[model samples]
Target: MPSSHLRAAFVLLLLLLSGCEQEAQAPLDQQLYIWQRQWRPAHAEALADSRADFSTLRVLAAQAHPGAGWSRIQVDRELLAADGRPLVAVVRLDGQLPDLDLQRTRADILALVDHWRVQGIVMQGLEIDHDCASARLLGYRDFLRDLRRALPADLRLSITALPAWLDSPVLADLLRQVDASVLQVHAVSAPENGLFDPARAQAWAKRWNDASDRPFLLALPAYGIALVNGRVESESPLAIAGPRRELQADPQQLAELLANLRRDRPEHLTGVIWFRLPLPGDRRAWRLSTLQAVARGEPLHADIRPDIQQSGPLHEFALANLGNLDGPLPERIELPARSCDAADALAGYRLERAADRLVFTRLNEGRLAAGQQRALGWARCEHLDQGGSRVYP
Candidate 1:
C-alpha cells in the first residue's frame, strides 16, 4: 500500500482500540463471605437483607491449623438451600500449617460436599482460603492441582490469593490451577497502617489483572478491628481488654474505588467479595444496609438522631443511627434538662452537668453502626424533653 494509505489505516486501528478502552463495562459481580466460625440465629436475617446485591455466598466450611486438628462449622444447609443463591464452600488452611495434608484435606472437603448434598444443598464451587507465604506458592500450587484433580469435574475450584504473591514468580502458575482467585486487599499488613488502603488496593488490582489469566475478585473489607496492646481483636468471641484503637474501612472511600473500577474495569476483574457478612448484632462489621448500599456504588450518609426516652422521672438518653452508613461515634451529646437529682454517662462518655444543660463528652471514638441505637447516659429529671437534645458528630 502507499504511505498515505498505510498511515490512515494505522490511525483507524488506533481509534478502534481507544473506543474499546473507553467503552463502559458491565457492573461487577458482588459476593459475600460468611466467615463466622459458628453459625448464628442472625444469619437468616443477614442473608435475607443482602440477597439482592450479592450473587454468591462463600461460606466458611472448615479450618485447619498446624497442631490443632481442623474444625468444621455446621452451616444451616436448609437455610442456605432455601435462599436459592449459589453457594461456594470455602476451606481455610491456616498459614501457620507446616505442611499441607493433601489426602486428609481432600477427604474432609469431599465429606463436607457429601454432607451438604445429603442435606439438599448443592455446592457450586470450592474455594481454598490459604494465605501462604510467597515462597510456598509452588507447594500451594501443587496442593491445589492435586485437589482439583481429585474433585468432581463439575465443581469449580478457586483460591484466595494474597497481595504478597505479586512479587512471587510462581503466581501465574498458582492462578492457572484454579478457575478463579479472590485477591484479599484488606488487612494484609499490620494494623498500624489501617485496613483497606484505597490507593494501594487499586494499584494491586491493576497489577493482579495484568498477571492473572483467570477471572478474579477483590476481597474488600466491610469491617473494623481493635488493636489492644499490639494485639488485634476482630469479630471473635474472645475479648482482649486494654486501651484499643479502632480501624475501620471507610464506606465513602470504598464506594469511590468501586465506582472507579467499574468505570475502567481491568480485564478478567470480575467483582468484589466483601470480607464478612454483617449481622445485626455484629459490632465490628458494617450494617447490612450499609454494605448493600456500598456494593451498589451509591452515595453514603450517617443519620445520627438523639433518642430520649422517659419513664416518670427517669429518662434515658441514646443515639440512634437511622441511615445506611456506619460512622464514628458522636463526639458529644448535649441535652437541655434541669435536674434536681442525678445524671451519669455511659462507659464511652463522661457527663458534665451544667445548670441549664448537660454534656456527654466522648472519651473514645467508637463505631455506631447503622440501624443501631447506643445508650449514652440517663438522668432523673423532673421533666426532660427531646426539643433541645442534639448529637454532635
Candidate 2:
C-alpha cells in the first residue's frame, strides 16, 4: 500500500532468509584415518565402536617408495564393511622420489579400487597422500591429473595437503585437480618442536581455506610418538633405551580447538580427519572412548591413581586409570608404610625407601590406557596405608 510499509516488509524478509540460511548449515563432518600398516582382529571392534561418531574411514591402502617400490596393506574386508560407513582408500607416495612412475602407480590404485568394488566395498573417494615439497607441487599436480582421469566417474578424488605447501604459488592449481584436500597439521615439521600446536594449526587452516576454493578437512593428531636419539617411532614399541621423550596430542587441547573452530569456522573448511584410528592396545594412540568424547566436544580428564593389593605384610603396587582419557603415568607416587621388610619397583620404575614411606619414581615415561592397569612394584610392610598413597605429576 504505502512506500514506507513496503520498505519495512522487504527488510524483514531479507533478515528472515539470512537466518534460515544460517540455520541450514550443518555441523562439521568428522572422519578418521586408519594409518596402521596392518589390519588386526581388534580392528573389527574398533570399527564397531567408532561407527557412530566418525562418518568415514580414510584407510591407507598402498604405498610406493623410491627403492622400496610398492607395498600394499591387506585390509580386512569384513571389518571394512561391518560398520557400513563411507570409505576412502589412500595411496601414499614417498615425497623424496625425484619422479613418479605414473603408469605403475596409476595401475596399482585402479586395480585396488576395482578389487574393492568387486568385494562389495563402495569407495567414496581415492586420496593421494604425498607430502611433496612446495617446489615439486607442479609435478604432483600433473600426477593427480593423470590419476583423476583414470579413476571412475563416480569416484571422488582428494589429496593429503601439507601446511608447508602454503607458501607455494602453485598450491591453487593442485587444489583445482582434486575434489577436496585434507590439510595435515600434525607432525609435518620436526619432532623436537612437538607433535601439534593448536594455535598454529588454526592459523594454518585459515590460510589454507583462503588459498583453496574446494572444501578441505584438517588432519589433526590423535596419537603420540617417541623420539629416540633423533628417530621418531610412531607404530613401533617404544624402547626405553637411549635418550627418549614422549610427545602426545592432548585431547583437551584438541577439544578446545574444535570448539573454537565450531564457533567461527573458515568458509571452505568442511570437517576434520583425526590421524589414526585408536585401537585397544595401541599405546601410542588415544582410546576410542576418549576420542569419541573429544569429537563431541566433551571435557577430558584422566583419573590415574595408585592401586594396592595387600596380603598380610605383602603389598603389590600398580597404577590404574579409571577415567575416560588415556594419559602418561605420573612421575612419582608416594605411600605411607611402617616396618617395611622389603620392596622393589617394576621395569619402568625405581623404588625409593624412606623411614616412614616408600616412593615409586618413574624411570621412563609410559602411558596407561583408560580402564587399564600396570603393576608398578611390590612392598612388604607390617602396616601399609594403601588409602594414603599419593600420585605426583
Candidate 3:
C-alpha cells in the first residue's frame, strides 16, 4: 500500500475514535452502609426516602485467626429477607494470621454466599471488609483471586481498602481480581486532632484513582468518635478512638467533600458511600436530612433558641433549633433563675446551678436539630425576665 493511503486510513480511524465519546455519568450517586446488628428505624426511613442507590448489609460474621488457627464470624441473619430493594452482602474479616488457611477460608466464604442465595436476599454484589496489613497484601491478593473464581460469574466482588494501600504494587495486583472498592478516609485518629480530615481524604482519593484503574466508591465518615485522654491514663495509648464522642460530620464540610469528589471524579469512580446511616437516637451521627443536604452540596445554618411559656404557677420551657444544621449542646446555657428560690428548678431537666443562674452545660445525649424540640423542665415563675436567659455556641 502507498504511504499516502496508509496515512489517510490512520487519520480516518483517529477521527472515528475522537467522534465516539464516553457517555457522561449522572452526578455521582449515593450509597449507604447498614453495619448495625438490628435494623434501625433510620434504615427503613432512609430507604423509604429513596436516597441511596443501594444499601449494603453486613451478613457474614467477622473473620479472625485466634490461637494461630482460622476462625469464622457468625452470620447475622437479621436481614433474612430482602425488602425487594437493591441489596448487597458484606463479609467482614478482621484478623492478623501469619499464614491464611486459604482452602478452608474460601470454602467458608462460598458457604456464606450460598446461605444468602438460599434465602430471599437478592444481592447485587459482595463487599469484603478486611483491613489486611501491608506485608500480607500478596496473600490477601491470592485469597481474593481464589474467592473470585469461587463466586458466580454474575456476582461482582468488592472490598474495603485503606488509603495507604494506594501506593502498594500488591493493591494493583489485588484490585484486578475484584469488581470495586470502598476507600474509607475516616477514623485515622491522632491525639487532639480531628477524626475526619477533608484535605487528607481528598488527596488520598486522588492518589488512589491514579494508582489503579478499578471503579471505586468513596467512604466518608458520617459518625464521630469520642477521644479518650490517653495521656492522663498511662495504661492506654495516645488518642484512642473513643468512648462515643458526638463528633459527627458537619453538613457544610460534607457538602464541600461531596462537591470536591464529584469534581475530581474519574470515569471509573462509582459513587459516595457514608460510613453509616445512623439511627435517630445517635446524637453523634448525622441525620438523613443532613446526608441529603450534603449530597446536594447545600449550606446548613442553625438558629437554636430556648423558649419559656408560663401558665399561672406552672411554666413550660423548651430548647430547640429552628435552623437546618444539627446543633449540639453548646459550651453552656444560662437561665434567668437566680438561685432556687426566685425560680425553683423542675425535676425533668438536667441543669446545673451556678452562683446566680441555672446553667446547662450539656444535654442528656441529644442534639438540637430542626424539628427536634426538647421539653425542658418547667419552673414556677409567672413574670420571669426572659432577657436574663442566654445561649452560647
- Model 1, poorest ten-residue lDDT window? 235-244
Expressed as tens digits, the lDDT of each residue in 1-393 for candidate 1 is 999999999999999988876565556899999998888888888899889899999999988988777888889887998899999999988998887777888898888778877878888999999989988889888988888888889999989989999999999988899999999999998789888899999999999999978999999999989888888888774465678787889889999999989877888898899988988677788888888888887779889878888888898888888889876788888888886389999899999988778899999967777888888888998856579877788
What local lDDT score does residue 149 receive in model 1, on the 0 to 100 scale? 87
In terms of lDDT, the best-performing candidate is: 2
Selected candidate, larger TM-score, 1 vs 3: 1
Candidates by TM-score, descending order? 1, 2, 3
Q: Which digits, one per residue and each the tens of the lDDT, describe model 2 over residues 1-393?
A: 899999999999999999977864668899999988877888888888888899999999899888888888888887777778889999998888767777877898889899889988889999889988888889888988888888899999999999999999999998999999999999988999999999999999999999978999999998999999888887686565797688999889999999999888999998999988988778788888788889998777789999888888889988999888877899999999989989999999999999999998999987788878999899889988878988998
Taken over the whole model, the C-alpha lDDT of each candidate is 0.87, 0.89, 0.68
Candidate whose TM-score is highest: 1
Give the per-residue Cα lDDT of candidate 2 at 49: 85
Ranking by lDDT: 2, 1, 3
Residue pairs in steric clash, candidate 2?
A: none
In model 3, where do residues sit more than 4 Å from their true spots?
Answer: 1-25, 40-43, 49-82, 95-98, 189-193, 229-248, 307-313, 328-342, 345-375, 381-393
Give per-model TM-scores: 0.85, 0.84, 0.74
